[model samples]
Target: MKEEIKKHLENAITSYHHYYASGKLAAYIPALLEANPKAIGACILDKEGHWYCAGDYEKRFTIQSISKIVTLALAIMDNGEESVFSKMGYEPTGDSFNSLVRMEINRVPKPYNPMINAGAIVVTSMIKGEDNNEKLERIIDFFKRLTSNEELSIDGKVYLSEKETGHRNRALAYYMKEVGILSLDVEDVLDLYFQQCSILVNCQDLAKIAMVFANDGVDINTGEELVPKYIARKIRTIMVTCGMYDASGSFAVRVGLPAKSGVGGGIIALSPKKLGIGLYGPALDDKGNSIVGMKVLEELSRKLDLSIF
Candidate 1:
């Protein structure tokens, strides 16, 4: 059964790789302009610890917005859910991932949830550290544990480029500071946020991390708690409700998995007790999610009975 499932997934990946070149790579961030717009990869880790990879699974990609999951995980591990929720939020708002409607309407102005950009900036500040370096290391360490890989770190070029052009994130930071929701210095918090987004991982590493979530935060091999079970559940719920930029609802309907995507053409999604999957393709839709990646997931869901509901 495992081998047959793997073959079907690989065939699907091969059939879909060409679709990436026909779409748009996110060009607003100049650093992302050069990714082979034609590239894609997919990997799945089943509950039994077997690995299956297809297409460019080894291709290196930055996590980009997908790092929100990492930073949020770190904040939960350090501060516990209660403290983290007090500052950010939990409900999903139907706005752009970076939209600030709540800040404009609500007294506090933080967004509806931590999965979006504003809430993510707030979550970034929640990590307990005296300085940015310490905070960043904690995030990195968390990623290492999730992926079981020690070498994960920021892509220097992507980090520099994003830092150079992160004006909107800067605005979110300052406004969050203005409302007193964000307790850290605007500059310091922005620095850490940028650094976190630049953390690099490929499809397989992301799949391994997703496997931890698939197992409800227990590492199958080590029987260790990488994240508290409820914490993992909360994060995955957010992923289902708000992980895709503006298309999260539609994605949930079509793909039926709790997943998160990044502008870097990377997505980490998982089927509980079944598989954790990662897909990458540099081309993007207007909402900043990978176009081919989304299609691949939709097809995978239809064929594999992987949807949650």
Candidate 2:
């Protein structure tokens, strides 16, 4: 069975490499522009702590918008899921990942939830911090604890590059501030938000992070509860409903795993007590998701019969 799963993973990566080359890399974030658009890697962790990998599985990539999931999980811990949702929401949004369409159509510019840029900025504002660095430290600490990797650190080049080119995100933050939905200073909040997105990790680290949710938020190595059971369940629900930006609904139907993606071509996906998958392919489809990443997950799900639906 181990050999079979290994072969399956290898086949998936081998068959899916071309899909990465066809898709474009995320260009809006200046730092993401530097990634090798052709690199495709995957890491899968099974229930028994076994690891299976293929392709460029060791390469590090920016967390990109995927940082929203960590911020949301922390918000749920700090403010409670009910309070967090009271301010945001859990429905699938049809707009682009960074789109501001609802602000013009609706009376309020506030976003539907924390997965989008607007909502992520608002959520970052709520995290208790003395300053931007401290807030970023808190987020990094959580990721490190979850991944059991003390080496986790921000890619400062990525952070500064994103900050330099993040006019749209800045606009979104300011608009939220205008409506009383955002309380923190816009620059400070954005600084924290962008820094979190700049956190660096490879497929191995992502797989460990996903396993926390897969096992209901307990650190599998230590058996310590990192998040409450209810909160963990809520995290998975949000991943399914909103994690892929606007493409979340289709992802739910096809991949059927609790997952999130970053524009840097990284995806973190998991099956509860079953498996955690991390795929990195620096090419993105129209929806800002990793194109080859999705293909690999779909094939794995089909062959492994893994689905949360």
Residue-by-residue lDDT tens digits, candidate 1, 1-309: 687778878878877777776689877678989898888888888888888888778988889888888788878888888888888667778787877666789866666888888889888888888799888888898899999999898888888888898888888788888888888788888888888888889998899888888888999889999988887888889899889977998998888899999999999999987788988888988788888888888888988888999
- Local accuracy of candidate 2 as per-residue lDDT tens digits, 80-147: 76777766666667898777778657765568767888788888888877787787788999888888
Off by over 4 Å in 2: 107-109
Query: What C-alpha lDDT, on a 0 to 100 scale, does residue 278 get in candidate 2?
Result: 88
Q: Rate the local accuracy (lDDT) of all candidates.
A: 0.85, 0.85
What is residue 192's positional error in candidate 1, in angstroms?
A: 0.7
C-alpha displacement of 110 in model 1, angstroms? 1.4
Can you give the lDDT of residue 27 in candidate 2?
84
Model 1 clashing-pair count: 1
Clashing pairs for predicted structure model 1, backbone only: 103-109
